[model samples]
Target: MSRPVSTYRVQLTPDFGFAEVAKIAPYLRDLGVSHVYLSPVLQAVPGSLHGYDVVDHSRIRQEFGGAQGFREMAGVLAAHDLAVVVDIVPNHMNTANAQFLSVLEEGAASPYADWFDIEWREGKVIVHRFADDLPQSEHYTVVDWREGPGYRRFFDVSSLIGLRVEDPAVFFATHEVIFWLLDEGLVEGLRIDHPDGLADPRRYLDMLRDRSGGVWTVVEKILIGDERLPDDWACDGTTGYDVLNRVNGLFVDPEGRQPLVALFTAMTGQDADYHAVMARSKRDVIDLFFRSEVERLARVAGASVQDLVDLLVEMPVYRAYVTPGEPVDPVARRIVESAAPNPEIARAVLYGSPEAVVRFQQTCGPVMAKGVEDTALYRWYPLACLNEVGGEPDRFGLSVEDFHDFCAGMRPFTMTTLSTHDTKRSEDVRARLQVLSELPGEWAEAVRGWSRQVSFDPHLDYLAWQTLMAAWPISAERFTDYLLKAAREAKTATSWIAQDHAYEEGLRAFAAKAVELPIGDFTALVDRHAVANSLGQKLVQLMMPGVPDVYQGNERTDFSLVDPDNRRPVSFPCAPNSAWDEAKLQVTTQALRLRRRLGPDAPYEPMAAEGEAAEHAIAFGRGRAVAVATRLPVRLAARGGWGATSLTLPHGSWRDLLTGGLYSGRTPLAHLLSRHPVALLERHDL
Candidate 1:
C-alpha cells in the first residue's frame, strides 16, 4: 500500500472552491504534494467557511462549485498524479438537513426517525437556541434546549445533531455518496471525521474498509497520554495529532514547565490538578451549557441528573465502545467502577442496555471537547505548544528518547500534521511561543512591565500577554476579537452564555492598551528563535517516518489564532517576501521533493550531535536522507554558536538538497546550519 508523499490541506469554501483548487494543481505538484487532503466538501449550512457543519451527505457542496466542479478538480489532480482523501462527517449533520427536518415534521412516524439519535420517549426534539429570536414552525415544537436526551448533538453545538452510525441503515445512508465517489476514482482514500464519537469505531472502520475495497483510510482521532490506536481498527492511522504532539514536543524546553506552572498558579491561585480543573469544568458544562445531555443520562440511569453528572465527572477517558450483547468494554467498566458508584448509574454504566451505553458514550465527547480542549487549554498556559488537542500541557516536554519510542510504536504510514483547520493556533504561532520556554527571565520581566501598564484579572493578564505575543503581527480588529473569544473560552471571568460586562470590558480595554506597546521588544528575539524552530520542526515532520501534511499557507509564517481567525484566505502565487519566508519555502519544497523521491516505506533512526551546542539541535536519518534542525537558537547563539558542535552525517558524500552544497564525515554543525538554520541532506547513494 502506497502512502502520500505529502498532503496539502485546503478548506473548500465559496471563496476558494474546486475551480480555484484546480488552478493550484501545478503549484502543488511543483511543491511536491502527492494528494490534496480536503476539509468537508459535502453540502453544508449556507455560507459556512469551515464545512464541518455538513447538512447533506449525498451531494457535493454546491456552495463550493458542486459535483461538476469536484469532478473537474479531481481530474486535474489525477492528471498531476495526485490522490484525493476527503474528510467525511458521519458523526453528525446540521439540524436543518432534510432528514433532520423530516424527523421534526413527522415526529416518530417519519421513515427517517431512526436516522438520528433522539430519545423518542421525550416526544420533543429540543434544539438549543442562544439568541432570543426563535423561528416558529409546525415542523418541530420549540422548547428550551437544556441538558437531556431528546436529540444527540456534537458537543454543545446544538445545530450539529449526532448520527446513529451504529445502525446499518444510517451507515449505508451516510456513506453511499462517498463510496460512489471512490468508485468513480475522484476520491482515492477516506479520512473519517470524529470516529471517537461513534458507538463502535472498529466496526464502522471495518465496514468502510470492506465497502471501499480496502482503500487507504485515516481517522481524526486524538490519542491521549500513552494511548495508541486500537490494534483491531482496520485503517492506516490517525490524521496526525499524535505525531503532531510528539514532534512538536521536541522543540519545547523541558525545563519550562515548572516556572510557567508556578506563574500560572500564583496568578489564578488555582493549585488543583489539571484533571481536577477539568472535572470542575465538566460539571459546570453539565449544569450550564449541557443540561439537556445530563437530563437524558439521568433518565437512562433512573437517577437525578446531578448524580449522573457526578459519575461522568470521574471518567478516566473518553467513553469506551460498549455494544449491547458483547461483554462490557474494560475501559468503560474501569471508569464506572473506579468512580464513587451510585447503584442505579453504576448498573447503567456497566451492564447497561444499548440505550444506556449510547447515552453514556455520547456524553463523553461533548464533555471532553468543551470541558477539556476548549476550556482547560485556554487556562493552562504552561508551554502553549502542549495546550493543543493531543498535547499534555501539564507535562513539561518530551525527550528525544520518548519520541523515538513513539516512532517505534505507531504505524509508519500514519499521517502527521502541524496545522489543521481545527488547530487552536497555527504551528508557527506555537513555535514562536515555544521560544518563551527558554526565555523565562526575559519573559517574566516583560510580563511584569505589562502588568503595571494594563489592569486585568491576574489570570486574564497571564493569558492575554501570552496570546498577544504568540500572534504578534495581529491586526487590531482581529486582536480584539481573539481576546474576547479567549476570555470567554477561558471562563475565568466571563462565559459565552453570560458575559460579565465589567470583567469583559476591562479585558478589552487591557487589550487595546497592550496593542499600543511596540512589538519590537519581542520581534527580534522571536525572529531568530522562530526561524530555527520552524525550519527544524517542519523538516522533522516531513522526513520523519509518516505521511506529512502541509496545511495550506503554512509554507510561510501563519501567525493565526483559532477558527475564523485561522480560516482567512491565503494569498497564493506563494512569493517569498522575506529571507526567513524564502528559507521556510525552500526547506519545505526541498523536503517534500525528497520525501517523494525517498518513496513511501523508508525507515528512521536518530543521529547524534557531538561537541558544544549539541543540545540545541535535533538530527535524524530517514533512508538516504538526513534532516538536521536547530533548536533554542537564542541559547545556542549565546553559547558561542555551535562552537565545536559537529553532526556525524551518515557516510556517503551527502549533497544538500536545498542549497546543492555537499558534506561528508563529521561536518561542523554551525557550517552546515548557518546559512538556512536547517538542512535536508541526501546521500549520493540514491
Candidate 2:
C-alpha cells in the first residue's frame, strides 16, 4: 500500500483549483506534506464551493480548469514527489446531468433510465424546473411538475439524483472519467464519498478496488459510537472519523459533563432526552425531507408502508448492506429481519418479499443523514465541541488507554484529522469550548449573563454563545448566517422549507445583541486556551499512528465554524496576527518533517507524568520520538501552573524539535512546556 506520511486537504472550486494548487505545490512540499488530498474535481453545479454535488462524472469540471489543468497540477505534484488523492461523489449525480436529463426526456425508453435510482412506478420523471420536453419529438415525454413528485435524491437536495451504482453498467458509466484519470496517472487514489448512501457499500468498494487496480482508498464513513468498519470491505479503511472522534475525546474534561448538562437544562428549561430528541429529529426527516421516498415505497408494497417507515426510522445504523451474492451479515440481517417479522402468509403482503427489504435498506441513508447529522447534532447542546461527525457528544471522554488502542488498531489505513470542511466547529473553537469544563462555574455565569442580553432557543443559544466566544472577532453578518443555519437544522423554531417568522425574528434579534455584547475578556480567554489546545492536538495527531491530513488553513489557529466558512480562502498575508499563524506553521512543518524522517510504523507507548499537574498533561511515545501536549491550560493556571509536574521519558539526551532545548529521562514537563504548549523530542542521535 502506498500511504502518504502527511496529507494536505484542499477545497477545489472556481475560486481555487488546479492552477492555484499547482502554484502552491512547492509551498506544500516545503511545508512537509507527502500528498495533496482534494475535494471533488468533477463537473458540478456551476458555483458549488465544495464539489460533492457532482453533475457530470464523465468529464473534469471546467470551472476548475478541466483535464489539461489537472494534468498540469499532477505534473507539478510529481515534480515535488507529492502523491494525489481526490474525493469522488459516486452515490449521487447532479439532477441536471445528461443521463438524468435523458431519462427525464425519454422516460423509460432512454438508454440511461436504468442508470439512476428512480422510482419509475410514478410513470414519468418529475421535472421541477422545466415545462416540457423538446418539441423535436423524442421516444418518451416530460410533463409538468406536480406536488410531492416521486423520485430519489441525495438527502433533501431536489437536484442531486442518486445513482444505481450496484448495477455493473451504471457503475462503469458513472466512473469512466475517474478510471481514465487513474489510468492516465493524473490521480493515484480515491476517497469514495457517502458510501453509506449506496445499496451495497462493500460491493461498491470491491468494484472500486478492481477498477482502480487496488490503489489506496478510504470511504467517507461516519462510524458512530463503537461501530467498527466492516473488515470485509476491499478498501484501506475509513476517512478517519473513527479516530477523529477519539482524538477529540482527549481534550474534554470529564468533570465538566454535569455542569455543561445542568447549564443546558437550566437555559433550555426543558429536560430533553437525547434519544428522544434524536427520534423526533429522525421522524421529522422521514416525514418531511423523505416523504416521497416513503410514498414510493408504499406503492411498491401495494399498501401504506407506515410499518416499513417505522422500521427504517428505528434503524440504529446507516443503510444495511443487502447484496445479491455476498453472505448477509448476521447483525445486519437481524436488523432487517426484526423490522419485518411475519411468519404468517397474509403478512407476506407487507415485507416478506425481497423488494420491500431493498427499499427499506435504501431509505435508511436519507433518514440517518437528515436525522443525526442535520437535526439532532444541532439540537444537541451539552458541549458543542464533542458534537463532531462520528463522535457522540453524550459520551464525555475516553481514557488514554482506549485512545492509544484505537490509534494502534486503525493507524495504517485511517486518515486522522482535527478539522474538516464538515466539522461543527474548528479545532480552536473546540479547544476553547473544552475550557468550559475546567471553568464550569464561570461558563454558566457567562452564559446566564449573555442570556439576559440576548435570548433564543436554549439549545441554539448555548451553541451560539460558545461559537461566538471561540471566534469573537467575527462579523455580525457571519454570526447571523451561522445562527440561522443552526436554527434551521435544529428545526426547533424554523426550518429550510418553512419558517416561523416570529421565532426567526427573535433569533435574528439575538444575533444583533450578541454582536454588541462586551466580549473582550471572553475573546482573551478563548485565545489563550486555544493556543494550548492548537499546539497540543496538532503534535499528538502528527505523531499518532496514522496518515494525518491537515485541512488547508488549519495548520494555524483556524477558528472557522462549519462549511462555507471553513471552506473560505486560505491566506497568510502580512498582518498583525501573521506572527501567530507563522508560529503554528513552523510547528506543523517541523512535525511533518520529523514524521517523514522517522516513518509511521513505530511502536506505541503511553507515558506517565508525576506532579501536581499530572492530570493536565498527556504523553506518548512513537519509537524514539516522544510527543507531550498540555491538556487543560485553564485548569493548569488555576492550580498555580503545573506545580512540580514531571514526565519520565526514554533515557539519553533528547533534542526538542519545536524548541531547541535539550532534555533527559526525567524532565519537568511544566518548565519544558513553559516556552510552548507542546514538545516534540527525538534522541540526540537518531
Identify the leading candidate in terms of TM-score: 1
- lDDT tens per residue, model 1, 1-686: 34567789988888999989888889899898899988889889889988989888888899888999899999998898787888899889988778877776677788998888877655666555533554554445555654443677788777888898989899998887798888887887778888877877888998888888888888988878787787789998999998888878888887777777777786667753787777777777766777877777767666777677887777756665677778876765666777635666777766766767767777777787787788878776656667888777877667777877788786877899999888888988888888888887788778777777776677667777777887887666788888788778878789897799988777677778888887557866777788788888898888888788999899877789888888898877687878878888888888888888889767888888998688777788888988888877777877888888898887788999878899999999878976788889999865
Could you tell me every candidate's TM-score relative to the true structure? 0.94, 0.93
Q: How big is the positional error of residue 41 in model 2, measured in Å on the Cα after superposition?
A: 1.0
Off by over 4 Å in 2: 130-149, 298-304, 322-327, 333-354, 456-459, 572-580
Reference-based TM-score, model 2: 0.93
User: What would you estimate as the lDDT of candidate 2?
Assistant: 0.78
After superposition, candidate 1 runs with Cα above 4 Å error: 122-124, 127-141, 147-149, 302-307, 328-336, 339-347
The whole-model C-alpha lDDT of candidate 1 against the native structure comes to 0.80
Q: What is the lDDT of residue 541 in candidate 2?
A: 82
**Which residue pairs in candidate 2 have backbone atoms (N, alpha carbon, C) closer than 3 angstroms, thus clashing?**
none
